[model samples]
Target chain A: MQAIMTLKQVNYQAENKHILHDINWAIPVGAQVTLTGPSGSGKSTLLRIMAAMISKTSGELVFDGQPIESYDPVLYRRQVSYCFQQPTLFGETVADNVTFPYRIRKQPVDHDHILAALEYVGLGEQTLTQPIVDLSGGERQRVALIRNILFLPRILLLDEVTAGLDEQNREIIHRWLRHLNVDRGVTTIMITHDAQEIAAASTLAKVVAGRLEVQA
Target chain B: MNLAVNNTSLFFAAMLVLVALGISLWQKLGLDKDIIVGVVRAIVQLFTVGYLLKYIFRVDNVWLTLAMMGFIIFNAAWNAKKRGAGIANAFPIALLAIFISTGVTLGVLILSGAIRLIPSQIIPISGMIASNSMVAIGLAFRSLNSQFHDQRQGVLERLALGSDLLDASIAIVREAIRTGMAPTIDSAKTVGLVSLPGMMSGLIFAGVDPVHAIKYQIMVTFMLLSATSLGSIIACYLAYRSFYNAQKQLK
Candidate 1:
């Protein structure tokens, strides 16, 4: 498979301290890649670099044969989505959060599509009107995930999004991710510490002391 | 009306400071030193400005008038910049906002024939405009810094979802503008009912008719409203961009 994203000699430094050192990686198209690392191992930094949420101090980052900087940032981000580890749902209610993707794109809100996605995540139609403060941790994560996929992206970057969820919620999220990867061919790069998730990933990478090593 | 303010009357007026100093001593408020210093500073500063204004009014040269206005505006911008410490290029942003707000307000007053272009008129009105705009810009900068820091997650979420900088930060920007303009708006709403403004009271004390003083006070009110609104809007729109980098990523 051809690589969808490539990074060469990526280095990030802050206050003269190196955070990510000499990272070189190629993410193949439609691949489900899991990144595992100890805390403060720079996994989130690498993901953010790929998402273009932060600039690389020195590196060549290419997405789809073009330099990452060449694309308009807003346009680039639409195709490469990033989700936070702590789910941040804004606005007044669930509908407000879910409808944001469409609102930004200037597309009319698709109620049926929203309903279907909500149901798939085990949320009911009434969840749309539910206040965001009423949501449980799992529900918030699910809503956040559903928000990202409402307007499908070429790549989905998850930063320990399933952290602190109960087993049932984790299983539901994992199943949904698998469906998206296998059935819909959405390339996924997830940061996880879950042993089961790491074991199940076909392609795994580990970051130790700011260096990346691929583990088959 | 007794308009005589000779050295004797001034000396008697200065004695009023003893009342405040005595209260501080009785209450053990630790404000006695501050009260003394404040009285001394006020007397020295006011006398210096009084003599300087007399000289400027006597000279009455356009360049001298402009130079004094520039000094006032510069001082206001410098103070406002201190409130915007962490924001990039905060000083220049504040300077521009204060300058434009002061210039536009004064220009309208002159062009509308509400006031003459003499140092006696231009200098005092310019001081009011610049100082008010300075305060508004400072408040706007403070609001922007705090909101951007506290709401970092919300901004990042929007950015990650592909919203542009303007869309992502519109809520914060509006809130900041409101924060800056709130004091000016509140004062406008309760102008005469709450207290007599300095300009109006001074004019009335100097034997101008109460009706005429009221008209000048109305003009001041209008001028301030215009100046503060322009200053707050300009400062917020410019400062919000500082939170983002050239690549549109939050710094």
Candidate 2:
């Protein structure tokens, strides 16, 4: 079966230092994979490369069998969403931030669908109209996640999404992530340092010193 | 009216020097030598322009007048570019905006016969409009570039959703224009109440009737408002375009 996403012998260098060396990894359609690594082990960098946020020095990246470079980067990014470690929400209101992608695309936003997405992420209806600055850290993360899911990307690349959340919020996010993967059949590739998150994921891949090691 | 440096002039000069000295001493609290150099440069440049204007007014040559206007536009562009580093192509955009805005406003004044097409009228009117537009364009360019940097990811996400570059940056561009023209808007709103305008004051000092001077001041202020608005909008649009690639995608 063709993988939903594939990285073959990918090597990346920055500032004359090798950041990612010979990374060969694949996420089959609908698979939930977690990447765990020590700080500066290139986990986030690997995700960035996969998301096409940065260019690789060598090798190939493929999305759904076609080379990633061939796919329009913007289109690929839309289909393959990348959630940063920190929740970055733009605009004054939560609704504004949520509807940003739709607004940019000139698509009419479905308020019902947006509310449903927020509800799924455990955010209340009130959150849609709240000022962005008023939202707590966990709320902001949920909002960011909601934005990603609202676009309904085929692949999700999350980088330490739950690092700053409390246990309760983390559990809430974990449940939603699992639901998205198992129920909706959305492919998820998450990078986290949390042992519990790694253990809970369907598959865990460890990276150390710029090399990938899959754990059965 | 005789042009003489009186006690008021000396007092004002002394006050300015004292302010400069205070600021220079305050540099100990993080003010650098560059600030002093900038003030010194401003004094030299203004004095030089004062001397040059004296001779230019006597000659009243159209070519010399136009040359000075071009110089103003060029300097405005240079300053805009200097302030808008990391956003290439800002200089030309600002230059075009200032040129078109000032030219249109000044042209209107000339066509209306409100101001004669002489060095005296064209020079001051053009200088005021061009300088105001310069500030507006500079602010617009700075705001647009900074907003682009801040919203890079948000912009990418929008593009991914199939939004065009212009669509993604429209909000930022609007914001830039608003910020750029804010000073002009404030000045127009508070004119005569907050302070006597330079144009009216200068005319009154030269023995022009207060009513006539008020008319000129009104025309100048309105022209500046229009020029600043136009320049800011044009510069912001061009600056927005500069952030994108040939394929109409954000770079």
Q: B39 in model 1: Cα distance from truth in Å?
A: 3.9
Compute DockQ for each candidate against the true complex: 0.79, 0.24
Residue lDDT tens for model 2, B1-251: 85677768965776766676677687664454666677679878988998999989988888888898899888877887776777778788888999999999988999989889888778888888888998998888788878998888777655544456677788899999999999988988998999889999988888899999999889988898889999999888777877876444566
Interface RMSD of every predicted model, in angstroms:
0.7, 3.8
- lDDT for B54 in candidate 1 is 100
Candidate 2, residues A17-66, lDDT tens digits: the string is 99899999877899889899899999988987777667788998888889
lDDT of 1 by residue, A1-216 (tens): 699999999999888989999999989999899999999999999999889999999989999899998999998999999999987898889999999998888899999999999999899999999999999999999999998899889999999999999999999999899888999889999999999899899899999989999875
Q: How do the predictions measure up, each by TM-score?
A: 0.92, 0.84
Tens-digit per-residue lDDT, B99-200, candidate 1? 999999999999999999889999999999999999999999999999999999999999999998988999999999998889988998998999899889
How far does residue B25 in candidate 2 sit from its true spot (Å)?
7.8
Clashing residue pairs found in predicted model 2: none
Point to the candidate with the largest DockQ: 1
